[model samples]
Structures are given as structure tokens and as C-alpha cells.
Target: NLGSPDERPALYRERSPVEHAANLDCPLLVVHGVNDRRVPVGQARLYRDRLRGLGYEAGEDGDFEYVELGAEGHASSDIDQKIRLFRVLGDFLDRRLG
Candidate 1:
């Protein structure tokens, strides 16, 4: 509505490559905060969906991982996760990539 399709062709052209590069078949870890206000969690979710659509694994058993830290706000700025979460993530990655 803001801009016609033709008016945004350049925008699409510039972003397509980044999206395509992200969709490659490889291991991906996406860690985020549920309360992040800067970048909506849905954006990460959409990216995960796109990567999954591109034939990447995206599940507990897949190459893609999504972790949502609760009440952590946008970043780990000062609110770090409890030790258990770190242990869980470390163990997960160790088992997966190790």
C-alpha cells in the first residue's frame, strides 16, 4: 500500500540475496529474548520458518535451534539467564555440534 511493487523492486533485489544466503543447508542457532522490543520475536520465527522451508532442519532434532529466554528483555545486557538454561543450551550444542 505504501509503495507499489515496481517502486520496491530495488528493495526486494537487495534483500533477496541475504535471505537466500540465510536459507543455506547448515546448522543454525537462534537465541532470543521473549521480551525483546527492538526486534520482534516473530521476525526470528519467520526467519526460522523460511530457513526450514529451504530444506534446513528446524526442530528439536533439526539443524535449526530456537531459544527464547524469558524476561531477559532485548539482550543479556544485565539480566543473564539462570545456570540451568546455560547448562541446557551448552549440553544441547555439545551433543549436536560436538
Candidate 2:
């Protein structure tokens, strides 16, 4: 497992995508679960805001998309939620790669 951020600050900073927002050159799709305990939803918000600060607009036609599932945890188990997640992924890919 990765070490504690407090004890390994350099490693954590190096591994954080938000820390490297300036290096992003492609469209990004960020999907997070609001109930996720492993990785708190705040991280997602930080990343989105970071990208926006770097001039990356977020939307279906923008440089990135952020989706937060209200009832999901780290991994979704509900069939309907899974379908919606897949659809969002597909739509993002289609818009970016199709």
C-alpha cells in the first residue's frame, strides 16, 4: 500500500494528478462516488477545480467531464448505476475518439 501522505509527502505529491494538471494534453473524464471512503469526494472536486484553473473547461464539449454518483461508493454495484456509468464513459470516449 502507498505510505501515509503525511509521512511521504513528496511521493504523494508526485503521484497526485492534480499536482500535474499543467501536463494534461487530452480530454479527461473524472467519475467519482460521493460516498467513497477510500478516496474522498473532495479529491475529485480539487482535481476538477485544478483543471479549471489551468483553463480546462468541464462539460460534454469541453476539455473534461466530472461526474459524481450520489449513492455510490468506491465501486458501484447497482445495475442501473453501472449502466449509467458505462454510458457516461462511452459518451465521453465517443466524443473524444469517435
Query: What does candidate 2 score on TM?
Result: 0.95
For every candidate structure, what is the RMSD over all alpha carbons to the true structure, in angstroms?
5.1, 0.9
User: Model 1: runs farther than 4 Å from truth?
Assistant: 1-18, 21-23, 77-85
**Best model number under TM-score:** 2
Clash count in backbone of candidate 2: 0
Clashing pairs in 1: none
State the lDDT of candidate 1 residue by residue for 17-59, as single tens digits: 3366464666566777778898777767777777767667766
Estimate the TM-score of every prediction. Answer: 0.63, 0.95
* lDDT (C-alpha, whole model) for all candidates: 0.69, 0.93
lDDT of 2 by residue, 1-98 (tens): 88799999999999999999989888899999999999999999999999999899989999889999888999988999999999989999999999
Candidate 2 regions off by >4 Å? none
The alpha-carbon deviation from the true structure for residue 86 of candidate 1, after best TM-score superposition, in angstroms, is: 2.8
